[model samples]
Target: MTINLTMALVLAVLYAVGFYLLMQRSLMRILLGIVILGHGSNLLLQTAGGPPARAPMLTSARPEEMADPLPQAMALTAIVITFALTTFLLALAYRSWTLLGHDEVRDDVEDRRIQRLERRLAESEEDAAEELEKEATQ
Candidate 1:
């Protein structure tokens, strides 16, 4: 089937913006990102079905002329999934706001501690290797 350039460009933009927002620290941006991405996915599914024509009824149209219903069904399913995930994200944002007074995600203290420990270990390993090399040279 033929592809629509305009639809393709729109999908690309939606996905690009979605991913950019998803990478942000703000919960609201992430929520918006999910929404945009969901719309992009739905659009992609519809586009894959080719140009809309006759219904998928054999009585109404021949097999070649009838539109495929699979893509529409899949798009509907995607919509439901997206809605559920967005609602969960919304709840999480709300809870976060209630607890922290802000919806921005912060780095965990424990994660930083582990990272510092790993860095120290790596430095010690490098020092040990340097000492070994010095001894071999001497």
Candidate 2:
């Protein structure tokens, strides 16, 4: 199966940027990231289908000559799902903005508590490691 180099590169870029944006605290960037990720997925689905050919329609073209319809259908489904997800995310963002004046994601108290616990655990482990090193040196 011949791979489309252009589509592959685009997919790679989309996935990279999408993930980077997804990691940000801004809701807008996160939404953009999801959309970009969706585009990457669609491109990947296309690449999974073999070489380019005619559309799989009721034409005079032979079955072998016609392009596989499955990939197209899958891509369409992905598009619809992505659209719905984007709309939902947008609505949430808008509501947050309207109520809070900004769409910044704030961590809850539990997150802070978990971070403190992790920090203490790390410190304890570090002290134990140092003690072990000192005993070995002696």
What TM-score does each of the candidates earn? 0.91, 0.76
User: Highest TM-score, which number?
Assistant: 1
Error of 2 at 23 (Å): 0.8
Q: Positional deviation of 77 in candidate 1, in angstroms?
A: 1.4
The TM-score between candidate 1 and the true structure equals 0.91
Clashes of each: 0, 0
What lDDT would each prediction earn against the true structure?
A: 0.96, 0.91
lDDT of 1 by residue, 1-138 (tens): 888899989999999999999999999999999999999999999999998889888798899999999999999999999999999999999999999999999999999999999999999999999999999999
Task: Return the TM-score for candidate 2, rounded to 2 decimals.
Answer: 0.76
**lDDT (10s digit) by residue, model 2, range 12-127:** 89999999999999899999999999999888888887778987777768888998878888999999999999999999899999999999998899999999999999999999
* lDDT (Cα, 0-100) at 67 in candidate 2: 85
Report the C-alpha displacement of residue 42, candidate 2, in angstroms.
1.5
Runs in model 2 deviating more than 4 A are: 55-60, 115-138
Q: What's model 2's lDDT at 106?
A: 88
On a 0 to 100 scale, what is the lDDT of residue 84 in model 2?
98
